[model samples]
Target: MESEELLGNLGQEENGVPKKEKKSPLISLEKDLTFYADSIKEVAVEIMMEGISLHPIFIAHQHEVSIGEVILNKADLNTDWTIQASTLEEFIQKGIIHPDKKEQFLKTYKKPENYMCVFVVVPQGANFVYYPYPKEK
Candidate 1:
C-alpha cells in the first residue's frame, strides 16, 4: 500500500468535520501487516529465541516511540510506519501492563511458540491480536 494511503486518515478529522467512522489502527494497517507477515514472523521467532516467551510486537503508524526493539520501520518514507518488538517484562516495567490487568493478560495470553502476539496501538485505543506463522498455507 502507498504511504499516503497508510498515514493519510489516522482517524483525524478532515477540514474540521469528523469522519463518519474512524478506522481502527489495526484495521487500517492490516494490509501492511499482511505484506510484512514473513518479516514479522521472523522477528517474533527471534524474540522467542532470546528466551522471552510472551513477547508482543507493537504496531503504529506514527512517531514518538520510546519502547521495544524496532523490527520494522519506514522512517525514510516520511509516513512513519513502525513496528516494535517488546516483551511482557518490558511492558510491566514501562507501566503499559496495568497492575489490574496483569492477571488477565497472563491468563488469556497466547503462546508465542504458536502465534505472534501483535499489540496494535492507535490514538483511539489498543488491542492484542495473534497471527499464525506461514499463514497456514
Candidate 2:
C-alpha cells in the first residue's frame, strides 16, 4: 500500500470522530523511570506479536504543569526507519532527551498545544531504547 493510503487509514474513524486509544498509565507527573521503560517495551513486544515488523514510536505530550500524555506511533509501520533513526540519534547526541528519564520526557515534548521532544524506540539487542528527535527552534 502507498504511504498516503496508510496515513489515510490511520486518520480514519468509524464515525467521523476518531476513536480514542487506551492511554498508558505510565503518563503522569510523578517520575517512574522503570514503569515508563517497561511500558515502551511492552508496546514494542505487542506490535511484534501482532506480526507487525515496524518499530513503534512513542510521542509524549505534556499538556499542563503536572499532567502529561503518551501517544504511540509506528515509524517503520508507516515510513522508513533508517532515515528516522539517524535523525533521532542526532537529537540524542545533542541532549534533546531528558537527562535521567528520557522516555518520560516524551510526555512533555509532543504536547497538543506546543510540540517539542520527539523520540523513536530503537531495538538494542533484546531491549529497546529511546532515540530523541531534536526540538525545532
Candidate 3:
C-alpha cells in the first residue's frame, strides 16, 4: 500500500507483476549521461576558447569537491551530473597537481585547441580524458 502510494497506483497486479512497468535504472542513467554530454559540449568549447589557458580541465561529478568553477549545475535533478571547469594553472594553484608532476602532465598533454580535457569522477574512480569540439557529423 505504501509502495503503491509512493509510486502512484497502477491498475493492479497480475501474475506477480505490477500493471505499470518500472523503468530500468540503466536506461535512466544512459539518458542522463547523454543529456549531460549534449548540454555541456558547447560550454566546454567556450571554456577552451576563452584563452584562460591552452588546456582547460573539466570535472564531471555527482558530489561536492574542491577546485574549479561550476560551469553546469544540475544538482536539482537527481540523476544529472554537475560539471566544474578549470584550467591547468588553476589545478596547480589548487594543489591538485603537484609542482613536480606539472611537467609530466604537460609533456603528455594533448593539443588544447583540438581537445577539451575532462576529468570524469564516478563511484568507480576518476580519470583525465579528452573530447573534440565541433562534434563529428
Candidate 4:
C-alpha cells in the first residue's frame, strides 16, 4: 500500500476518504414480478437457517411436504440444511398450510413478546431467528 493514499493532495493528506457506501435496494413483495413470488417460501427459509445448506421444509406430519416422505424435524435436518418450518401445524387440528385457505397457520402458537412465528417472516430481516444458534459460552 502507498504510504499516503491521496492523489489530489500529492501525499500531504493525513486522512483517506472511504471507497464508497452501499445500500441494498428495497423490495416490494406485492409488485415484484421477477423470480421472488414462487421463491418467497424457499428464500425466507434459507434466511432463517442463516445461510446454511437448503433443506425441504419438514411438516413433521402425515401430509408430507414431498410425496412419499412424512417425518422430518430440526435435528433430522442436516447442519448444511437451511431453514425448516415446524411441521407442527400439519399434525394439529387446524392445518397451517391449507389449499384455498385465506390465512396461514399463524394463530395457533403464542409467540414470545419480541419474536414472530418463523413461517410468516420474510427472509430479508430474519437475523434474530438465527442469532441464538450455537449459543455462546
Query: Candidate 2, residues 1-137: lDDT per residue as tens digits?
Result: 23222123233355788656645433431133222444445554554466543333343322111111233222322422211111233334444433565556445333222211223222111112333222335
Instruction: Please state the error at residue 18 of candidate 4 in Å.
Output: 73
The global C-alpha lDDT for each of the candidates, from Candidate 1 onward, is 0.64, 0.32, 0.63, 0.28
Instruction: Give the range of the ten consecutive residues with the poorest summed lDDT in model 4.
Output: 126-135
Instruction: Give the clashing residue pairs of candidate 2, or none.
Output: 60-106, 60-107, 61-107, 62-107, 109-117
Query: Candidate 4: what lDDT?
Result: 0.28
Clashing pairs in 4: 53-80, 53-82, 59-87
| Candidates, ranked, lDDT | 1, 3, 2, 4
TM-score of each: 0.68, 0.26, 0.60, 0.18
Q: Pick the candidate with the highest TM-score.
A: 1
* Superposed Cα deviation of residue 119, candidate 4 (Å): 12
Sort the candidates on TM-score, descending order: 1, 3, 2, 4
List model 4 lDDT by residue over 55-124, tens digit each. 2222212111321122223245332122234433332323333544323433443322212223312212
Regions more than 4 Å wrong, model 2: 1-33, 64-137
Tell me which of candidates 2 and 3 scores higher on lDDT.
Answer: 3
Whichever of 2 and 3 has more TM-score, that candidate is 3
